[model samples]
Target: MDHLYAMSLDLNALLRDWPFEPGMLKVRKVTGVDGREKLQMRIDLGVLQMELTGRPDGMRPHGCESLLSYHQNRAALAKAAGNEYELSAEECSELQQEGIQYYHRYVSLFQLNDYAGVIRDTQRNLDLFSFVDEHSQREEFVWNFQQFRPYVLMMNTRAKASLLLNDGKFAEAMREIESGRDAIVEFFQKSNFPELVSKSSEIAFLDEWLEEVSEKRPRSKLEIMQREMESAIAKELYERAAELRDAIKMLKASK
Candidate 1:
């Protein structure tokens, strides 16, 4: 009798030697075999294709909707059934795992200069926090996700500021930075993690960025004018806002 020996392959190890550099990431748009459009992040040793909507892989853990949707709907049903809505720790952990997958994709997207994709993914994670906070109300779980809030906000604001800066919207970029800083402070305050609000390196980075941006601009008339217009609008002074808007248009035309 003749016996054949089989060789086993360690694919993960083999992938480490992929042609791409370890830190390099690429986002490619491709049509899947099923004729669906997919956005895929190609990293050093692997690829992650995310769904444009719904869950990343369209995974609904526990045969329920996304943790967010599930809890919202279940909360409604529970109210109707005279029951209370609660998410078990297992479900919370599962949702956290799902968020981790998106986190990987967003980080890769950021490295690849896909800032818009980063914003999109980061917003979805924020929505996850909202859902968990609304339904769970478990201090530990809520705090766990809250602790992650600032980092996501930081990345989101980075993407926003980058886009605005690319568009020559200096004032808008500054506003984004300020908004992100305020959001981080608010999150920490609400969660009773007040000490961390002032201590976070992310907040410090935003402050540094804001200062750098402030010094970089010599107050281009259009930028200054536009900021005034935005302030007017925020204050419900539409007439003044319109006047400033027209003035800005005229200024741009003069230039």
Candidate 2:
């Protein structure tokens, strides 16, 4: 056997040290041999490695940052030349394959709590979907990628809301979640799939998450006092309600 080939084929020690868990997303960041940071995901068979940025596989298709960027530039040049451009079936397939590379990296990034990276990659995929939808030569090609749009939108929303949540802005996070849900609904409606509004798993996940976050959110002192004042007024306790109202006024004035 060739020595270099044998060495390249061996991964027994690496696999032994990091056993894969069936249902867990095992990911870690490490410096590559070339001294750049990279991500690794443990699978049942072995580990899959990805670059930290710029086209997860580190390939610049057609000398562009990504296939989508290359195609977009092509479309722009075509328009400038007074000619309409459309993607061939082969081009659409190639773009979809490139998208999978991004999908893997973003999913791993999300697990590693790198929400910004997740947002970046997911948004890129969404752009790819839109570009393909508008320029693909066939409706079937458009649907092939459009079907995953809701799930991508959901992940993008979660990442955005999570960044706000990390900054201790629960109200802002809730608003972001609501906006994200509305976007998904709009997508369904635009796709003429209004009946899917109630059955969408992405919407369901956000709904449940919104409830969970709302329940766990901390109430401000003003909110507590206002609630108490409302209760007092409802019970006809004029004196108590008047005292609470005075405190609320002072609180609002202080702010």
Candidate 3:
């Protein structure tokens, strides 16, 4: 199993200077060996879909030597979510539930061989990254207690731009759409887990959703920030309102 890690290292070493954009592969993940050893696997191309003989080790294979290697003659595994990192149990449950819905909505996307649909739906799932442990939201890490964001936004923006380009926004949304492209690439690069390449967007939609959730009903901590923003707005604090808006995700469904 450990040899898998060496193989992956070799692959990376080979491709490190390929000059191809890193996230171009779209898939990122570590796989355990033959279901018996959880020490290694390969990455690239797409998400982990192998039915290994064993369950996930419940921990990411770490270290250059401890990680597994890529399967022989097999393509590098891609990540289903923009992220390919681990998480806390509670957070994992929430993400899994959301992931199912994402997969279902576009279930036919893949069935019909709609690669675009696959991209859109997959990106949306990653963008809506959620953390049940609310406090963890303050920290922006891939394994931040089941949280999934940043990268998702990048994928979502690209998906949106692709769809929008096909729609009627070609002329009007050019600036934002282009900005999204750069953002998607930028943010993805900064992401961990599946190791999203840098990507960007016009608006951090998920961040807004969280803000709306905090404001619509006001959780204990949210209530205070909500008040501050309201008061600031009343005092002509346009900047403050904008800041607050950017700071939170507007959880309309939470209502």
Candidate 4:
């Protein structure tokens, strides 16, 4: 009789090598046995392996790339037939679950400093939220998913601004942050949750980050003179203000 051996499914060696940290997102990219790149996140329990593209788990639902894509095609077909299509509560729940998979992938991508991937996934979730909000049969299902809009918006904004920062465009990054802040505020107001704006941690974080970026941004000579002129005028120093104003005019003319 031939001796038989079994392949072990245990992750003991893998988890032992990469111990989980308490407050850090530990992620890595590796080539799979099939020679395809994959993302692996280290968690407290063990490890999570994800596809670098497409669905995180690399599963296709309804023969479509994603649940969102599948539903979008269905909606398009219904529209062409002059029929209205709305997502049922169960379908909405399914979408919510699918969104979670994308969320995990984006968060892991962010940790890997892949800002573009982060933006792509966040934007996808935002589109998913809009679709469900527009077509969900129940308001409660819409609310459940839409409630996370602010957080996703913040992540998207952060990624855009980070890309600008990477290119050493501090002023542009600041503007991007401002735009993101406005978007969050608008979302709250439109959702009839204006009261939450003041208490929004996302908005507060962006505001603080914007201030820091502004303080560090390099200023042109003309901009500096303009700021000085404004300060002098506010302090009732007409002579200083007039001098700065004339200097600023000369600088602008030279430019």
TM-score: which candidate is best? 4
Assess candidate 1 and give its TM-score to the true structure: 0.69
lDDT of each residue in 66-114, candidate 4, tens digit only: 9999999999999999998899878998999999999999999999999
Q: How does model 2 fare in lDDT? A: 0.94
TM-score of each: 0.69, 0.88, 0.28, 0.89
Put down candidate 2 lDDT per residue, 32-89, tens digits, no spaces.
9999999999999899899989998889988999999999999999999999889999
- Show where candidate 2 strays beyond 4 Å: 1-5, 226-255
Alpha carbon lDDT of each predicted model: 0.81, 0.94, 0.43, 0.92
Q: How close is candidate 4 to the true structure, as a TM-score?
A: 0.89
| Cα lDDT tens digits for candidate 1, 38-62 | 7677665576777655567878855
For model 2 the TM-score comes to 0.88
lDDT of 3 at 214: 36
**Model 4 segments beyond 4 Å from truth?**
1-7, 225-246
**Model 4 lDDT, residue 11, Cα:** 73
Q: Which ten residues in a row have the lowest lDDT in candidate 4?
A: 1-10
